[model samples]
Target: MNFYKDLEPIRRPIKDVLAEQKLFTNFPDNWHVVVADIVNSTQAVKTGKHDDVNLIAAGSLIAAINAAKPFNTEIAYFFGGDGGTVIVPDEIVNKILSGLNAHKINSLKNFSLELRVGSITIGEIIKAGHELKVAKVEIGKGYNKSVVIGNGLKYAENIIKDNYLQDKESIEHQLLTIDSSELNLEGLECRWDRIKPLTSSLEVVCLLIEAVNFKNQSTVYRDVMIKLDEIYGEADKRHPITMNRLQLLTTFLKFKKEMMVRYSKWKIGHFLKAFFETLIGRLYFKYNWKVNDLKGQEYLEQVIAFSDTLTIDGRINTIVSGTKENRLRLLEYLNQQEQKGLLIFGHFVSTESIMTCYIENRNDKHIHFLDGSNGGYTEAAKELKPKLQML
Candidate 1:
């Protein structure tokens, strides 16, 4: 068996490969899986702390990626609303874990959220009678999104939660002694306001969909994608991160507050610094000044490129903005298929959505994290489980 030096080069439109599931490659046995999420995200979201929850989850990814920069392959990660899943080569598993533990400490100190992170290896997964399949989806000119399939991820999640694997072997959690401030979050920014839909009647849907048979998973997901395109038109028509909708914090108090969240608590000098920076940012936004190649038409394209509006891993997950009528139409179509045992899905609706940005220099290395304002994917999964058992 031969494995490519990298997985990003074989990218295809997600819809194009749904019917050709064989294109996915088995994960290398030398790799390890790292999982992390907020421990009590639902309770936090109920208290209107979902934004913080989302930020912490996105923060964990940044920490892990920055930690894994020495690896031969880029880490493949999936961002759940309140947490995230990651895969990396075994050589850097401990390094990634250290970074995650660092993130966990920061979450506790800053947001008072407990972030649980643990690691498991691919060899154990295959030994336990499961497989991990990976594929890449081309989202933009040079960006390829990583997608994972198979029951291995879900199985790993269970192992982490239950400590099914012992401390020295299967799954292990480490508490690293390091300053959380030292964790790298270079591009993580929460500068934008909550995004409103294209219209008042429009609704935002966060969906997680899976098929009854693993072989049919991609095909069923492809149908959902087709229906969505018909209802919402092109990617630009439905993307929520538009430059026209961007607004920056101008008030001294609000800017100071944002600064505290992004960095540490403010000092007198830091407060004044934030005030001046806020004023400069206001001018930047008002005039739409260029950030190297990131301004004008190129910036809009980058926004769309970085937006996490839609994604496909083993399951089809998306944070989409559309009309109530179209949403109902989609559910009707999916439910009809569900009746035939073709697929199962969980969906949550919201009037608006939120975004977090990660920009590593503002040229092209940037991607946005998106989620429905409250209980988007998490709450929907609550309703989806019972249906899965019945089917």
Candidate 2:
């Protein structure tokens, strides 16, 4: 008898063959999966101009990828005409949400594009992919959108996995059952959590991945702070703070402080500068107020006049001293504004002295200082708009 002839024939599982399909080549184990579909692709193709639709689709995809990257997500596969999948890490959940929110807002505002995003954990992917034939059967019944099943079929496997059943269920429910309104609420909470002093020190770094992306550090920082304040104020109005809540609040503040310091070298200064300038511009127009040496005074005056507003007793105090003196003068002006019913202030700082200003109600004094170190008055004015809106 020939020993070779007696050997049993080699058998390979069908599941193994399917898993090796070209579409699932980049699938990673132990990952978080994100599937994003462009809403109304068929309509986009039928009624929309090809160029316009392409622009919208390209923008949407770019935004999604940018948002996902900060969360440590790797792009698994993207079907050009429909959707894509991303594998995310657990640590960057907050960043992912921030990116997604920013992307969604921009897309809606610009192109009326909508995206539906679903995320799951790695363990779920493996479990779902265990029996490739069964998973394929499910896909055949219109469940190809399932990332794990797609992976098993060698289509696209970008499923998220985790050990916590409750967490998984919460995420899944959020993805499937929650509407945009519910997402907005959750998003607001997530934003608050990022900037709260309690969590600010948690080292939640956002990776900037797009040239036109909207995740400005200063803007995010300011918005989160505002939201947290809103939440805390509401909670305070309802009940005396429990120790746990107070502790959480305190932690959030600390975390925010830490994040500010850590991300100081980023474009935050530019954002701050822009915020101040925009505010000044608006106030100038609103009250017909002007700094003696400011360049845009005429244009701003026109704006005020067009809006049917006139100055109601505003003062300008120019400081000749250095930057420190300028800050003191501005601070002093703020205090004086608190005393008077009307206050409007503006100044341009030379290299030797910082140019900035503040306006306030006599009874509701608020101080605003724009550092000359950041930019000149013109540049600072451009930066100030968003900050004013925040106020």
What is candidate 1's lDDT per residue for 146-225, written digit by digit as tens? 77767788778879877733553322233444556656665566766777776787788888888787656667777878
- Most accurate candidate by lDDT: 1
Candidate 2 TM-score to native: 0.28
Query: lDDT scores for all predictions?
Result: 0.74, 0.31
Clashing pairs in 1: none
Best by TM-score: 1
- TM-score, candidate 1, is 0.88
